[model samples]
Target: MAKLTVERLKKQFGTSIAVDELTLEVAQGEMVALLGPSGCGKTTTLRMIAGFVAPTSGRMLLGGNDITRVPPHVRETGLVFQSYALFPHMTVAENVGFGLEMRGVSRAQRGPLIAEALGLVRLSHLADRFPKQMSGGQQQRVALARALAISPKLFLLDEPLSNLDAKLRAEVRTEIRSLQQRLGLTTLIVTHDREEALTMADRLVVMEGGRVRQVGSARELYEEPRDAFVAEFVGRCNLLPATREDDERVRTRGGLLLSSRRRADESSSASTLAIRPERIAIEPGHHAEIKGQLEAVTYLGAHTEYQVLLGESERVVVTRPTPVRDDPMLSVRTNDPVSLTWDTEAPRLIPETAKD
Candidate 1:
């Protein structure tokens, strides 16, 4: 395993830039996820690192060696493609040993190495099976084994779990995380799923418009987002246009006053007050700090989502655990008057100038 560094990495197709001044570092034995929506350049960034796509400008270092111009086969980076690109005619053992063969390992020497890789993914028994005969999950494991057989300096995965069913996806992700930790592998994964990133990565890099928006742990991104876009994109957030009224207060455009734990920095620009769905509390009466008309109620199994319209236009979603039998909220309906309140520290002030 090796530490990977990218400096001012950029990629462009003609006039359109796919990645813009991207810089990141992945520590040895740590897993970092590149998270963003489709077309945000995450896959492009990964391909650049893996030497599949040449960068327009910038440098990449692996274990203190400059590898920006290295060929893909010589980069010593194992990459698992999104489609699990396994040759249909090859048996699982042959697929796993292909990388070793490319590196000049003889057939006599490749047997134990292939067995070890397949064992790491718990697929040793299926080594004789072909890709077309195995389930999707099994095929994914075979691809992982193939990548692992080469003992790569850097491990890269591109949406490795996207094709699996929900239950299988969860199980496979857990297995991957466990194996990565056990082997102390330095990994970089490109994915658009927030839950997958949050649960699997040691750190997350959130990207938008081909540039990084924020890089931090899941808790830091969710609790202390730097801007409106990061605040809303990382999770469900209620963003209302407001002007800073004081050190701890802001008045929303809809004529409602709210308190925030963070004071807006001394910028006079319009700001946004961000509150999490579960932070706001609602009661049956209209006597609280803010009153709103309940617009809709959605039962989401473990939790209930309430859409409340505050004043003329501000609609906020508040989530709470499902109430027990005889609870008054269980009987609340749409269009009912409700009182909303929250602790002074529940809301955060973010610059409204952040563009999507």
Candidate 2:
């Protein structure tokens, strides 16, 4: 609906800084997710965008218009909260039409608009039901419908699907993504859940300690994290302590040499290495780089997980897609000798601290 530009956005609650020098841009009709752990300033950042919280310093531009000082009601941005925030006494249609009503639209004008919004969320059949009469998923959809009724330029959701059960959460997120795309709506989602952000957003902005950590596509953030915090936060990673060896290599503590990406901005040439568990392959040949004993095996429906004990103190976890044909891992036992290795380019070496 609109391009959102947040420049040098900073917020301080007295002496405690909530968001520091944060800057990000969301393209028109693109969905971006603010992903992080609890208390990472994601919610605060969303509030500032919604104009509910004042920024100590910064500017917010919506569709080339400055909305930094605009009142929330007049910002022309639709916001949906985690709690749904629907009135219990009102029926579904009434709740969806409430925004239009507040804008002084007549009852005749609100009917089709409310119906269209409800249809977008597939809740037209439940228009007469109250919040207490519907499931968590249904209630949340109603909240989404209500937000869309105003035809706002920017759509914002703060943990919008967190209240639903796991199955419902997965189902609803897909529905929301499809709906947003169909309407070409510019949307921003705030989520702590990794898979939710990975699946729903076109791009991700990982934040921590009142600052942006890394921003990229889901694959970039997962496979090419800029720092250790991002590597561990975005996905399953096996972090190994290593000594840097020249420009593109690191020697592990156990004397295993591995290739890694080295950055020039890094003060130290060498740093800790991050390797995804799924990238590690189990080799049948005895000449594999690292030898270990398979400590445990877990059989997930789609993937088989292996826990291999490397040396005495370090254990590496590997997850591989289940083969179409049944294999040895199905009958694999603990304490079996095995060798693990990975491609040269899969491992990423990142600094202990982020580059300014």
Local accuracy by lDDT, each model:
0.91, 0.88
Q: Where in model 1 is the C-alpha error above 4 Å?
A: 264-270, 353-356
* Local error of candidate 2 at residue 279 (angstroms): 0.7
- Which residue pairs overlap in candidate 1's backbone? none
TM accuracy, model 2: 0.93
Best by TM-score: 1
lDDT of 2 by residue, 1-356 (tens): 78999999999999999999899999999999999998889999999999999999999999999999999989989999999999999999999999999999999999999999999999999999999999888999999999999998999999998899999999999999998999989999999999999999999999998899999999999987888899999998998878778676788887776666565544464367888999998743345767888888888988988888877667789999864556645555688788888877788777665777
Which clashing pairs does model 2 show?
A: 1-186
Cα lDDT of candidate 1 equals 0.91
lDDT of 2: 0.88
Q: Provide the lowest-lDDT 10-residue window in model 1.
A: 261-270
